[model samples]
Target: MARCETCGNDYDRTFEVHMEGKTHTFDSFECAIYELAPRCAHCSVPIVGHGVQKDDVLFCCNHCATAVGVHELRDRA
Candidate 1:
């Protein structure tokens, strides 16, 4: 049995996620992705897929990037 680090639940069927050399256990997929997922800079939404990047900032989509005035490269296209 493993303890979920995020929700502090003692789970017998928890899942593990390894990221940046750190291991985390979660009792459910919601806690796993919610606690470990990256969020968009503009809208604060969880970026599940490969998000749009500009410089060092991350956006959930091109519209968010453009809305934040960071997608200059995309605006030219």
Candidate 2:
């Protein structure tokens, strides 16, 4: 049984269907699309991931990921 990485819900017959590695799971195709979808740098709309790399850090997205400066979060650890 595959589980949703976000909601941590069991993919049962009540959800949408998708194939991953020969196994089938339920998670609403919309959710899957959202994961793959791009987002705005400032907002959270579907956009794209791009940015500059400093030191050895990587900015997943230029717009959304970089805008939020998630690198700070990564450095807190």
Candidate 3:
């Protein structure tokens, strides 16, 4: 059994994920996404795709970036 770091719940069949040279365990996909997913800095929602990053904050989309007054980065080559 593994314990979830976020919810402090123990699970019989938990999934493990490695990120940033660290290991994280979760009981469900939702938990894993909640714990590991990149979140929007302004809305605080989980960012599924390539999120916009301005300065040190992350945004889910251009609307969110515009709403927060952060200049969104352009596409790469």
TM-score of each: 0.81, 0.35, 0.75
List candidate 3 stretches off by more than 4 Å: 71-77
Model 2 stretches with alpha carbons more than 4 Å out? 13-26, 47-77
Q: For this target, which candidate reaches the highest TM-score against the unseen true structure?
A: 1
- Count steric clashes of candidate 3: 0
Best by lDDT: 1
Question: lDDT of model 2 at residue 61?
Answer: 49
Task: Write candidate 2's Cα lDDT for 2-74 as tens digits.
Answer: 6765456776543444445443333665565566544443555653334334444444444334565554433
- Candidate 2 overall Cα lDDT vs. reference? 0.49
lDDT, candidates in the order shown: 0.86, 0.49, 0.82
Q: lDDT for model 3, on a 0 to 1 scale?
A: 0.82
Lowest-sum lDDT 10-residue window in model 3: 68-77
* Full ranking by lDDT: 1, 3, 2
